[model samples]
Target: MAYKDQKLSEEKVFKDPVHRYVHVRDRVIWDLIAAPEFQRLRRIKQLGTTNLTFHGAEHSRFNHSLGVYEIVRRIISNFENRPHWNNEERLLCLCAALLHDLGHGPFSHSFEKVFKLDHEYFTQQIIIGDTKINNILEKVSPGFSQKVADVIAKTYKDKLVVSLISSQIDADRMDYLQRDAYYTGVSYGHFDMERILRVMRPMEDQVVIKSTGMHAVEDYIMSRYQMYWQVYFHPVTRSAEVILSKILHRAKELYESDDFIFKLKPTHFISFFEGKVKLEEYLKLDESIVHYYFQLWQEEQDDILRDLCERFMNRRLFKYVEFNPNLQMKQWMELYQLFQDAGIHPEYYLVVDSSSDLPYDFYRPGEEEERLPIHLVMPDNSLKELSRHSDIVEAISGKKRTDHKLYFPKDRLDAVEDEQLKHRIIEILYGQGEVKDVR
Candidate 1:
């Protein structure tokens, strides 16, 4: 048999906590899993800084990636005998699903914010560039690697294949919602996934749900909404994220300072600080490698860098209070100066973090990031958008909910020896004459 047509004599099954078992029969998938590029995911956490909040959320991207592939595999199995489901696209969909998150760096979102790097771009490079994964994909056909990349990029001509992985209710979201919930030990992510899968119908360009499964889809949507607020956007998780992003920023700032000399050179971060990271260099800096640097930087001469590292390594996280952007603009400015007066560097010390989620949204013309809403197949075989059919979905559809918080090290504010300065700052922060900062 040709390389692409090769299969193992017996199926290989990985015991998964979420899926129970992830079965592999295709040689291509087994090889891809073993590839060094894909294996790097084991070191990258699925939910960055979240593990610090929920100890059980120590799962890695490798775990979630495998779960995504398994979900897609089951989905495709259902699609096989159905009309409009092309068997030829099966391998492409499977590969795309598995490799979709291949390029996520350690503490992915925080790293991206600090370094201006896009994981999706790196994922495309991994698929098409000089790498073991690219070689495996190229073995399938001359341009097969690019085809996989395009599918991931959502530019593939086969919109049906694209929807299977990238759509709002597709395998990627389905897997992560359950997997993240499982790892975090939260009840919000639970939903009737089996029913959703059973009701899935492949269309010419997309997947539609049978009207019978509308309730199940609604449950999934609400589960996602609850998970975002309760687990994904937990204030504690955001606190750690704020500190992590600051550590990256402080390190980058010191790297660019001409007068500053590192007692120990930041070898792992030099490329990232310079904004010209090579693919190999990017691959080399996983979570363990980042933690190693964080440990060493704890002893650095730079007080800000050393202090931030200590806070992250020891879990001395910043405390946050709800922030109203419209009303608190002036208050925030005054507090910024008060922080500076108290010898706390406002730049690194005070940060406003905002998180927003749109549980479901229909297509909006000319919007930069358009969400293709879920559709339901009616009894008469007509298709209707999910929000139109379900009152529950309609209640929150297209209406984005946003939360903002101002995060700062309350311990540092407490250590401010200037009693009046502390009291005044506390007064603004807590609206009390007492100096203690209230939660």
Candidate 2:
């Protein structure tokens, strides 16, 4: 038998918390799971810094990836022998699903933000680059690896395949919602995924849900909305994220300083600091390596680096207040000057973090980052966009909600010996007579 067509001697199953059991039968899938590059996901957290807030959210990307693969597997099982569902693309879809998050770094989003890295770009590179993953994919076919990369990058000619893995209601979202919800021990992410899956129909260019399942789809969309606020965007988790980003920023700043020398060399971060990270150098970094540096840097001579690292490593997170930048520019300027006057480095100590989400959006052509809206197949076999049929979806459809918070070291503000300066700063931050810990 061709290597690409080979099956495992016996089915292997991973007992999963959310999915119960993740079954693998293909030899290719088994080998891909055992590949060193895929195994690296074990060290990357599914929700960076969220475990600090929700103690149970310590599950790794490896766990989530397996869950995603299982979801796609079940989805394909339902698609078999159905019209508009091409069976030839099954393995490609599975491989793409399993390897979708291969390039996520330690504290993935923070590292990406600080270093201007794209995990999706790195994901494609890993599939096409010189790596174990590439070698295994090459054994499948001459250019099979590229196919997987295109599927992940959402550039494949097969829109149906791309939709299956990446649409508004695809396996990736389905798995993470439940998986993250399960790990975080939250009730919000729960939805009837089985019903949604059962009603899924593969169309010429996309997957459509049977109108009968519109209620389940509504629940799923609402679940995603709630998960964003309750778990993924928890204030405490955001505080930790702020510290992690600052730690990376400080490390890069110190690395670029000509006079500074590290007490322990930041060898793992050299390429990233220089902005020319090779694939191998990128892979060498994981949470363990990052934490090792954070712990050691807590003792560094550079006070900013030491302080930020200590905060992240010990969870001495900055406190925040509701802030609107446009209306409070004058207040912000005054606060910035006051912080400087008080001998606090405003650059590192003061931060404005904003988060926004569109719970659901109708399709809009020519829009940047346009997401294809979920479509429902009616009883008469006509397709209609979801928001048109559900009042619940229409209410919030295309409406973007945003929030901004200004994070600062409240402990530092309290320590100011100048009573007049301390009270003034507090008054500006919290308004008159409203001084309190917002955390």
Candidate 3:
């Protein structure tokens, strides 16, 4: 009840590119951001190895977290006088948005793949465990931390609040879709977020976009579609991920093998390899620490370890070409043998990367794991599923688009003077003509 009247004497502001200025007027919100656990977001890149491709995408999760929080703040501010909007849930929404990504570690997706770590688990830990975030949340009310976690976990009883953060067109998607686009300098992610936010309405158990704003909703869905293919699932990004995964795997293998002696001994990677990493150890890891290991490993005695590290650090990304798995199986095998004959390890050099996404899905009744589909509030007060009314959404709804690429080091192939072997490999990769830039 005290929070109803509580506000910071001097509002805190974070200069943000996406949101312009993220303002915090609540004492609890300001304290939550200052918490060491939340501040750790500064070390984690928002797009991981994406900075390798889009150099401007060097922004951190801290930037995104603040942007998400600002978006939620604006949404709550907009919903203040709307029907079915509870003033009590305002702080909870803001807290959930600010702390949602607190659990993300350095290169979250790649680290999680290698170590099997769950950032969501750590997200709940930071809020509910004995940490600064927990202490701050508890100050608001007993069990407030759990309440905040519930909202993030999407199990909060108030579906409206859940929808605000996790729905098809919520603040989380709204912020990232635009923020990532801005940082990546891509035109596809441009959507009228202001128009979308203005048209948002809180309904029973869900949020809906007014039918008049259907075009805006269509734009948002299309933006998501483009961002997914053009940015999130870019083959080059996946290629980088493949190389990173191999680097981690190689380090783990070396640590297990008696032949390998690391210069730094890979102390940070030990617990991860042994599958007993502590939260504190995990927190110590950032891109810098990982890069430190990679830099040292460049001078490692093991060729595989040194090569992978050098390739990753120097941006010598694996080259890729379109290939079907079933049809190209024989060619892939021959390429592998060719690489072996050429003294290059086929395992590391040859890779196939694929990425896919379902842009939108209409709610299917009786489906156990159905997502609450986006609904357009019609002029006559009836509601329609997004795809039913919007042509673009209809074109992409439940449509899974996929892209596959065969990756290899083209620079290595170009230097090979073995005309017979080089031609065979090049023919397999590029078919007839030279491989052009996929972009």
The 10-residue segment of model 1 with minimum total lDDT is 357-366
The regions of model 1 sitting more than 4 angstroms off are 356-369, 398-400, 432-439
Number of colliding residue pairs in each model: 0, 0, 0
Off by over 4 Å in 2: 356-369, 398-400, 432-439
TM-score, every prediction: 0.95, 0.96, 0.92
Query: Cα lDDT of all candidates, in order?
Result: 0.88, 0.88, 0.83
Among these predictions, the greatest TM-score belongs to 2
lDDT of 3 by residue, 149-218 (tens): 9999999999999998888888888888889999999988888999988999988888899999989888
Sorted by lDDT (best first), the order is 1, 2, 3
The TM-score obtained by model 2 is 0.96
- What TM-score quantifies how close candidate 3 is to the native fold? 0.92
- Candidate 2 lDDT, 7-63, residue by residue in tens: 988889999999999999998999999999999999999998889889899999999
The candidate with the higher lDDT, 2 or 3, is 2
Give the clashing pairs for model 3.
none
